[model samples]
Target: MKVNVKYFGAIAESAGKSEEVLDLEKGSSVKDLKNQQIKKYQIQDADSIQIAVNQDLKNEVELKDGDEVAFLPPFAGG
Candidate 1:
């Protein structure tokens, strides 16, 4: 299964790219991909990172082919 991964805010800065397509095995979970990317990019503040699948916040959700996964960092507003 192939998933579209997107990085936002500090995540994108750390990754040095906004988006990429990942080829994952069937039954992959959001957590699985998140952990891989975090290690791959050495992303900081992993505890604060959030994963969104198909526009909905998800953690252990099972991924499907062509799903869109977004890596979002903490956001602040005054």
Candidate 2:
């Protein structure tokens, strides 16, 4: 399955891009993608990253082909 991934803030800096498409194993969960990407990018502060699937924040989700995933860094409230 292929999914579109978007990175923001520090996540984009770490990933070296703002977005890309990823080919993942079928039935891969959000956590799986997180783990794969974090390791691939050697991103620090793993626990600080948040994921949203198809524009909805998700903890654990079965990703579908063409789904959009966003990796968001910590945000400060003003």
Candidate 3:
């Protein structure tokens, strides 16, 4: 299954791009994807990153084909 992954803030800088398409095994969880990308890009502060699946924040949801995952870096309210 293929899913769209979007990177924001520092995550995007680490990834070297804002978004990409990744192919994963069917039934993969959000944490699985997070682990894969975190290692692949060597993103810093992995624990501080937040992810929204298909526009919804999820921790352990099963990913489906065409789902959108956004990696958000920790931010401060100004």
Candidate 4:
């Protein structure tokens, strides 16, 4: 299965792109995708990042072919 991924803020910078297509195994979960992304980007502390699937925040959800995923770094503002 293949999924579209979007990155925001620092995550995007780290990924070197605002969006990308990720090829994953069928029946992969959101966590699986996140792990793959972290490895692909050589990211550290991936657990701190937030993830959204098809524009909705989710974790452990099964990914479908062509699903859109987003990775966002923690926002710090007052």
Write candidate 1's Cα lDDT for 1-78 as tens digits: 899999999999999999999999999998889999999999999999989899998456789999999999997768
Per-model CA lDDT versus the true structure: 0.93, 0.92, 0.92, 0.85
Give me the candidate number with maximum TM-score: 1
Where is model 2 poorest over a 10-residue stretch in terms of lDDT?
54-63
All candidates in order of lDDT, best leading: 1, 3, 2, 4
Give candidate 2's root-mean-square deviation (CA, Å): 1.1
Give the Å shift of residue 19 in candidate 1: 0.2
Pairs that collide in candidate 2 are none
Steric collisions counted per model: 0, 0, 0, 0
Give the higher-lDDT candidate: 1 or 4. Answer: 1
lDDT, model 1: 0.93
TM-score of candidate 1 versus the correct structure, residues matched by position: 0.93
lDDT by residue (1-78, candidate 4, tens digit) is 889999988888888899988788899999887887889888766878989888888556789999999997887879
Better of 2 and 4 by lDDT: 2
Candidate 2 has a TM-score of: 0.93
Which candidate would rank higher by TM-score, 1 or 4? 1
After superposition, candidate 2 runs with Cα above 4 Å error: none
In angstroms, the error of model 3 at 29 is 0.7
| TM-scores, all models, native as reference | 0.93, 0.93, 0.93, 0.85
